[model samples]
Target chain A: MGAEYDQHVAVTDLGNGGFAAELDEGWVVGGGVNGGYLLGVVGTALRAASPAKPDPLAVSAYYVSAAVPGPATVSTRVVREGRGSATLAAELRQGEQVRVTALATYGDLAGLPDDVRTTATRPPIPPLEECVPGSAAPEEVRKVARMMARFDMRFDPACVGWTVGAPSRRGELQAWFRLNDEREPDPVALLTVLDVLPPVTMDLGLMGWAPTLELTAHVRGAPAPGWLQVRHVTRNVAGGMFEEDCEVWDSAGRLVAQSRQLAMLPR
Target chain B: MGAEYDQHVAVTDLGNGGFAAELDEGWVVGGGVNGGYLLGVVGTALRAASPAKPDPLAVSAYYVSAAVPGPATVSTRVVREGRGSATLAAELRQGEQVRVTALATYGDLAGLPDDVRTTATRPPIPPLEECVPGSAAPEEVRKVARMMARFDMRFDPACVGWTVGAPSRRGELQAWFRLNDEREPDPVALLTVLDVLPPVTMDLGLMGWAPTLELTAHVRGAPAPGWLQVRHVTRNVAGGMFEEDCEVWDSAGRLVAQSRQLAMLPR
Candidate 1:
């Protein structure tokens, strides 16, 4: 870990019905804090605003710029508040330049008939000990991993032994992750974990240098308590961009979220 | 504008690397029927065969599904011919199931400073007409105008109309479209249009639905040009389970796609 990490929430006077928080980073690398960490921060902030609520259903952040280590601030503003849902806009800033901007939606629990169907399929989850752990990731990745210990990840050997000349598309990996400190399962927390795993796995599978340019995830059902299984598959690598699609499943083998990401491979 | 929209190509597969083609559906929705189109179709299919591609530079498809009023087939495959600078995939499909897939990469297009840095910022091109046009649209959309002609679209005014309602944290809409018959720009052509217009614009600058979701775009730049721009946006209604996001845009201002879906909106 890069020293101790700290975060602080700050409210702004924008008065648009949103709240903003400032995060103090001890040693966050420029490109280290991927989408997962940002989601965690945003989720924590939103949870704080709604003391009586559990957490957000889904929150999305746009990576406008890389989050560097040191003190940074986050601001959120409410856009609409209805009986069932609420929307908030959050921004993270270092100095004059804005680092990240996000939109989060919150709502109450409404039981639904189990009739609705979903097409998401989860990969078989092997025991964490049986799987292989990923090799040392990029320096930046390690920095963020230390800050968030929620995920228990393992890599397949195929990923670590990849070579440029011997490019193969068969490399795959699986991660068994859940909330740190074992908090009751919540949708927002589940999504946060889903967003983080794809990039790491993709990087390993391709044995090619790549970073996510954008990520979008759709939730199919409510999350249940248990270890979430993420099976990441890399389908294409061309030009300088790669794509990864992930299927997230709850412990009961229930599919929760289906995610896709577009990333730029290092040249 | 041709007599009895002709059948261009046929989609023969639906695996990872799939295909979609333009049938007798008047005019193809997006890409043209030629080598460029084949390149993209094959790319997507190839990526699907082995490892999935990361960043899809652009995607153009032939209106293959019942979604469009036509009969066609699609065939797709991978063409891994380039080294590091570029990666390409292709797709070709038609008829029901609208089989079409593409996975491509432009690798890293950034490098040594060539004294020329072209960051041309164009003023927002005014909509074809001063006011939204009058055209026929699907029932889901409350009003239909030439704005529909300018692009392919399906929209609901209640969800994204000028009217106001309960406050929600997020909102959304979806649309399918492409540019009017004129020129065929490369992958950058479609992205150029998308990158400029913020998804938040679907709100019509409404204050209540101000929260913006992270925009995620998947592109399979193909030959069939002309019509391209299908989009949607959703807003979080309440309880964090109901969120809405809108998609609105067009190829050269011709609206092509539109949609509205519900999501878990948390409070």
Candidate 2:
């Protein structure tokens, strides 16, 4: 089914060091695909075109309209090239009306000296054996999980029972996650993972349904070994919008990347 | 100089449920004050007029021109009234031209029981004695720090010294900070604090000058106790643009808000 969904989003190599992909209903909500899955498809396409050592640093997508999931296309253009960073702009469209537009960046690896290093504290890692898996995962997660079974995510047992905790003045969460599918690690895949991290954490805390309005991430260092640690926190949930921030650390404790998202809660 | 700067950009209440402020020299650099600060001042003015509690959940601003900081006015209008959220649109004008436009929301606080609650781990707090004060000493700290002094910030000595650690990555830093200002805090102040947090943390780590380009924050809960903790990390630095995400927690470790910002590094 995942492969079937992947097949629907077609990739076009612009040939001029750029690429594009089309996302149609085979990936839309009513058609069984959702935004999350489409995002995955887009990430995969961008990864396929990146250099072997491509490291995705940031991606910003503007949703122009709801992608019905049948047939849509994404086109990417290289906007700027620099020694440290490269910028690429990608657009998802259906027949002419743009559905989504994204600007992503990739960077070459340049190690910082020890004196320049800095790191955020990682949340306590829970033993997978002790933690219970997530309860009825969101439809989006379930769909993505089925389509792309590359990551293993273990939610705290507290998250599954619906006994999560009261919304304190400060919101906080810790989860264990890593790629389930083994392949040459690509920056696009890493960014896709970062985009998904906030929803689960938000779900574990919010009283109502929270749908992401926008998501932005920054890749800081080289990818870490195997397992990735995600520490996510929601700072405020007012109006219909909520905000979440996450820190992604590699198994070795190096800060790999960080993400922030704006989500609109469903009525 | 700082007081003079404030006067130049001082926001004025326009009365009749509207407010205005001028963009002055201090607010502009190459051209204008940072876009994020412009939105922040307008949001602050809107909050002052509404009877509703001031908790900024989401805001959208468009850059029209470089606002001359010396004198500007903000006019806010109620866009919509919903069962749970109130939407407002604010315009910042300098003489006749609309310099900036913004949309903001404040939700009615309906105390609801939280279903999920988990706090992310915070960095180990360094003792005040061991921590180095911010780059500005008593006088500079007093002047520039007004925007930040409301927050209790403890920088890791390594960051202050611009030293990298084993797990450190370039363009990243981890520090603990909370609102320490004595004034009754409002959503505007929260926004101001959020804007101030990232630059300090990033500058301390990268040892580079960083200025904000855009900031979007989600206010999850009402302001917490006097203290709030923040963890800021820079994700990427490329194309003269950089980004950072900050997670804010109250004294109890509950996540209160989180923010993301796009910035330009000083050439």
Candidate 3:
């Protein structure tokens, strides 16, 4: 199941609960490394120390500052270890700067009992044929065009408005998503995909890179194995900050992951 | 602004980077202290040391173990302090057990630059007169009924089903919320409000107390005075766990806060 994404987030154990990761340059958006990519790096480090099968059910990270693309060190601590679940904490630092502080809860997802199963409604995802690329960014707005090239995002046709400045009235976008590298979605991959969606504030015609201040991802299950149905929504944009809520329903239409991030609103 | 809620979360600064808070027994749910209550206590401790106004814009906490209501100690560290934003990390420990680990982002909402604004639709909350008390608890489910008594929650009339074993067809709920004590809603109060709603999974016919494993809240703006329009949705319930997505829309119909929590489903 290891794909190119594994190489990008791979870390080397340095013993004494420490691991070092070489930040992938391709994952950098703007001057800062991508928040989701960093999350994977941190998750990978914590997974190495997880007592259970490293299925990260919930991971929350606070970005202390931007980490330039290079080598970063992750220091992990097992906060509480249980038979089926464990809580691990880690600090990702480059040089003397702590770039991210993260807390993750890992457990054996498949091994846990799924007795009382019930289904919920999923966002309507457009067919791949009717869908287009993620964004309609023109030359002026395509700052992360390079970053977008790395994901095979088949977006809803309705997402075209923000590009030419005829944006939607509400801040919501639906899309079909999968990694460009063709990696099978895992808990770590799902964490990254949850953050890869374009900020929903774009529909309000806001412009600028929305750097995530804090992000939390909860993986509900191992994805049913295929393209993910994604929905990103923003209900408010005020005081130079906003929250983006993203949900990923697996290929079989089973809900797999949900995330919320507090990010700086576009300037 | 001091109310009974404040007294419950009040802490004494240890002069060093530490604070001591006497656990308020009334806030305990089940055998464990409420996650949001501990969040408010951590937020309060972090606010005292924030270089900014200490308005917590985002906070995420991971429960290491259940913290029984009693005297607990909170040790805080100012991770990064900026002109308008700050990041703080803290751990809540009872005796030798570390119960909760949290990271918080503090910002000055009124002080931050708010040049542009956009609005999104809010969930339609039924009139308080049309609504009813929160839940139809049986004698067995009445354990948390005393805690529920503290909040003036005008629940959606539709929530009456689960009690009679006739739950809603979907994993969604709508309610109007405000402090039962009629205290003005502030950042800390918002944190507690985000966690008070009955677990949406109950609508799927799941029973028992759902202890939160991790919870994250993002504050968008201070609420205008009055009852808040709130909605809770659960998309996935798997592996003995589930995630609840909650949104808080102010009386003015402004999106004031949003939160997501991962919790153990009722056994």
Q: Candidates ranked by lDDT, best first?
A: 3, 2, 1
Q: What share of the reference contacts survives in each candidate?
A: 0.02, 0.05, 0.75
TM-scores of all models? 0.51, 0.57, 0.92
In order, the first chain's TM-score in every candidate is 0.72, 0.74, 0.93
Give me the candidate number with maximum TM-score.
3
Residue A156 shift from truth in candidate 2, angstroms: 3.6
Relative to the unseen true structure, what is the C-alpha lDDT of residue A253 in candidate 1, on a scale of 0 to 100? 72
**Candidate 2, residues B41-115: lDDT per residue as tens digits?**
776677765556455765544444556546677887764554545556566777777665555666543442353
Clashes of 1: 170
**Per-residue CA lDDT of candidate 3, range A66-138, in tens?**
8888999999998888777888888999998989998889987788786536466786766888998755555
Candidate 3's residue-wise lDDT over B152-175, tens digit each?
Answer: 777787875776789985888788
Candidate 1, residues A37-118, lDDT tens digits: the string is 5655666666555544434644544444566555555665554444444555556666765555555555443343353333
Per-residue error (Å), model 3, residue B106: 0.5
DockQ of each: 0.05, 0.10, 0.60
Please tell me which model should have the higher DockQ, number 1 or number 3: 3
Top model number, DockQ: 3
